[model samples]
Target: MPLGADHLIHANVVCSDFERSLDFYTRLLGARVIGEVFEFDAGEDFMTILGVTGGARCRAALLTWSDDDTATYLDLLAFADGGGHAARTAKDTGLARLGLRVRDLAAALAWIEEHGVPVVGGPVTLTPMPGRQRHVVTIRDPDGTLLTLMEFPERR
Candidate 1:
């Protein structure tokens, strides 16, 4: 029999400003720094793999959780020479938008509002996956990147 996967390994995100992204992940999201890599060694390799040019001067950072609770790791990347394209709007595109699971949807929305982030959608119920329930709220970050904060009280 095939073995069942325990957890997700990692997720990669390309950012325009490496420092700002790192700060957002570390400060706002509470992610800890696991490792960092300079450009000269793995920059060219990454650019080639990503099908991009002039990214040899970029920087990469690997971040992990504080505990081994079987959570997905995040790879924060910045391209010094060749910045990637900006994130598309949710109305016009179907792309990646970071999802954060919070305990209280209303409290989280309040905190996010106080922080000056604009809320796109309401604290509404979504039944996209049958038999699964998710209370979600959408917001836009400083870079206009859409993010969803979900509360899974039913799951708990």
Candidate 2:
């Protein structure tokens, strides 16, 4: 069945700490919370929706970028029990990465460095079109989730 969808409404990033995740996305990447943080015992429906059989407690916050052209929603979730496990980069399969775009790639990478976040790799030029060149970088978030950041180069 082809599910007709408008666009990606939100993506979930399970974290170990709500504050840390919030700071990482909001403080670091400039995403603003769209709604209040929700806290409750992870009911059967929640666990089911998350594709899990257990884990009863969860706290989640909806996030969106202020500078983003699209809504670009992200849900920063903190789950209890094994749900709070740090991200794994091993070959074990799952949602391995999340991509993001920023206005100033260099400054964003610098922010990651200044804040002591692990950089997966240095920035590389993407589309080297004159007057519209682009760059990309890979880095690890607070929970080790890999994120790719892209931006247009500054004209000098």
TM-score of each: 0.74, 0.81
For each candidate, the alpha-carbon lDDT, in order, equals 0.71, 0.79
For TM-score, the strongest prediction is: 2
Which stretches of model 2 miss by more than 4 angstroms?
A: 67-70, 84-87, 90-92, 128-133, 153-156
User: Could you say which candidate leads in lDDT?
Assistant: 2
lDDT of 1 by residue, 1-156 (tens): 878977667877767777887776676656787755444545566668978654455577777655663457777766556555765777665555778787788787787777676788888989877888889998865566777889887766
Clashes of 1: 0
Model 1 pairs whose backbones collide: none
- By summed lDDT, the worst window of 10 consecutive residues in model 1 runs over 35-44
lDDT for 150 in candidate 2 is 82
Instruction: After the best TM-score superposition of candidate 1, give how far the Cα of residue 129 lies from its true spot, in angstroms.
Output: 5.0
Tens-place lDDT per residue, model 2, 115-152, is 88888876888665656767888888877888889885
